[model samples]
Target: GATDADAAVAVAHPNIALVKYWGKRDEALFLPVTGSLSMTLDIYPTTTAVRLIDEPADVVVLNGRPAVGEAYTRVARFLDLVRSRAHRTEHAMVVSTNAGPTGAGLASSASGFAALATAAAAAYRLDADDRALSRLARRGSGSASRSIFGGFVVWHAGDGDGTAGDLSSYAEPIGGEALDPALVVAVVDHASKAVSSRDAMRRTVATSPFYRPWADSSEIDLVEMQKAIARQDLPAVGEIAERNALGMHASMLAARPGIRYLSPQSIAVLDAVLALRADGVAAYATIDAGPNVTVLCARADAARVTAALRAVGDFVDPRTAHLGPGATLVPGED
Candidate 1:
């Protein structure tokens, strides 16, 4: 068994995909239809502590409980991948905590997997950069491929073959890539989402007629979003992101056993955002597998956006909304 004192900890934040990744071409490798853009949030993230133990019973403890069975298998498989390059080492005990709600449809898995990959790599003294660590993290969760880096990140969805996919999977560091730092205002938190992202994507890919169109158009969206980011064009970026997110959800609606993540409150919040845009507010909303909405706005306009959200009924959390940092090691501690 491992003691707390012997553990190495890493902290990483969940990222919101600006260019949403909906359908996957290869389920086993978690390959997406096209590249996705994301920004790591500073407020909500996962912190993981990993320590090597001198026992054969590799174990994982998440939020205080012993992670057994499937969860253990998943983490073990990831560790096995890292161990292939790293020298054979003792089993490890890992404890993970998500700053945000675990099953709230947020990208907790992205940060959780990234933090685990980083802590595991550090605990074993593995020589790896952000990209290498990202590749390892991607094996654990598809969205996690971008969480390995901070600021802005793009995950290039390569060809379906494992080898080609690995080579094509690229993560770019775009934290300061834009001339202006963008701000993401979270409008709602803890809204109940009916379907989990995993289930939604699986169903969408298997049944949605619109899935093919979404996949086909992702390349254009990727190119335009990148250009908008490069130019620091907030309006262009927001337009592209909102459209991409809508496209993703549309596919979900087209699924055989169709389901909608949008709740009455979700639609209300979306309408409010559009109203803000019409009123000349430079803001837009994007959602993922959850009803919670994140608003993309300029850092300077964050206060105004927050005020606008507060003016609405008790549908949003003012405190939970804020700008965030990318995936990084804990200062002074790591």
Candidate 2:
């Protein structure tokens, strides 16, 4: 039997969406308005360890520091879900570490919650398969569901109605074995964003006139992206990725206050991507809810893309990421 002191650890990698997930039809359940697809990156992994404690409150330590406020509360609430499932009243101590920058729209939360959900389930003795675990992670962050799988993954938004909606929303892997792709992560600013993705997404959905158009087009993008991946068409994939990301930003820009995640340096990288395309290299850029830009290119062209972005002389440090593995439990640790 699993005891309150039994600890479990798991590691997960962050994934960048090719078809973005922006709005939520059910915010409480973290159900997205549309489906999304992504590629798990080789860089920026999060390792989390969880253990049930005999305390009245949960204790969380994030990246070696005592977490407070929203960060602590978020982890505590996630644990509450695990507790409810296990039928245990004991609290927990969660320690999470991120290999890359947290926030900054780099999908840190995706990795964090994925790792947390897996470890907490194991520590608390909850019997769950990957799909069940994906749903658990989705409760923490919509994108976290995709982190449960690696290489190429697609997250179904599920039906919007509250009746058994969560079961329909889960992430599954899309094979890309014959494909060799790379994501060049250009970090313009590593600091956390002024507005969180959750708030920004709601504002865009509520205020932006372009939101509906973007959401509708995202469905088509998801279909075409899957086709492109199946045939390993790098150019077609890049083209769809670039336009889809730009459209997402356009919807956000139409918001009342205008959520601009792209900075001048981000544009510089985008321009460099355009220049690379002009020179016969297939490259495309995407930005999440932060100033950082992720450029998708061929593995053979990754060095070229990295050099081109470095030539801009504005990015802090650029990293080229190959497709990474899915979430896995840490071996030989109890």
Candidate 3:
């Protein structure tokens, strides 16, 4: 049903990795040191449209303003990849909008690039499968590979076997419908991060002594996480996710000069999550490279989790999200 078109718009949602993807094995290829498992959230969808224009240069507009700095560079570079694949030299205009804050640990880049990759593939008439698109999205953001699928997904680290190994690094969906978990996203802060995640990861990999140990343990965590999801064990899933995320932060914290993304507000939310769990609620906390925290709990406990998070009085807002669908090309949703 999908074919080449003059222009196309696509939508995708961000995915929060439970087993945490911290450092990259291949920086240029965006391959992780260890594989990761995640749940694609139903919230914060990114919509992007790409249209070929008869212009000398590509144009990029993000969230209602002309993209500048790293944002513009990433979009243009990703487009270059698509151009090379499609074998079309025509420049294009890319317009994108994110429903939530970008680069603030909300996985905005994940959804943004997934949507862009889908749109570009369709616009350029590149007949590629979902796995192929996942690889394409990974060029823009490491986690974006998982955004290609819905529900629970896994991104394989593949091998370090050069070009052939790169093919194994795409994300794929793993069934977990029975879990039906809910994620309560606590937004403590939404401002742009001073240090980008990529930079932070590089620093941690290069400097932190804890990085290797954590990376080693993460592989075992991934195995347990997959088992937990397979058996529909919400508490196990939550616990593994929380500890893995905390370990990721620990590695970052141990970096030379030490980098910290968790603020007082972030810790407050985390404490609340623990409190909820102690109070007989199946809840656990996970944080990304930024200050915000996401609470994992059973679907039935989402409202209670949200209320408890709000009572912490630290977050700007807290909302519940469920499993989301994969990226898709929309005819007019843009």
**Number of the top TM-score candidate:** 2
User: Per-prediction count of colliding residue pairs?
Assistant: 2, 0, 0
Pairs of residues clashing in candidate 3: none
- Taking the tens digit of each residue's C-alpha lDDT, what string does model 1 give over 74-127? 888887877777865578878898877665667888888999988888877788
List runs of model 2 lying over 4 Å from the truth.
Answer: 1-5
Q: Which window of ten consecutive residues has the lowest lDDT sum in model 3?
A: 1-10
Q: Candidate 2: deviation at residue 144, Å?
A: 0.5
Segments of candidate 1 deviating more than 4 angstroms: 1-7, 68-72, 87-89, 175-194, 319-324, 331-334
Residue-level lDDT tens digits of model 3 in 292-315: 999999889999999998899944
All-Cα superposition RMSD per candidate: 2.7, 1.3, 2.3
Superposition error at 24 for model 1 (Å): 2.0
Worst 10 residues of 1 by lDDT: 178-187
- Candidate 2 yields a Cα-based lDDT of 0.91
Which candidate do you rate higher for lDDT, 1 or 2? 2
Error of 2 at 87 (Å): 1.2
TM-score of each: 0.89, 0.98, 0.97
Estimate every model's Cα lDDT from 0 to 1.
0.77, 0.91, 0.91
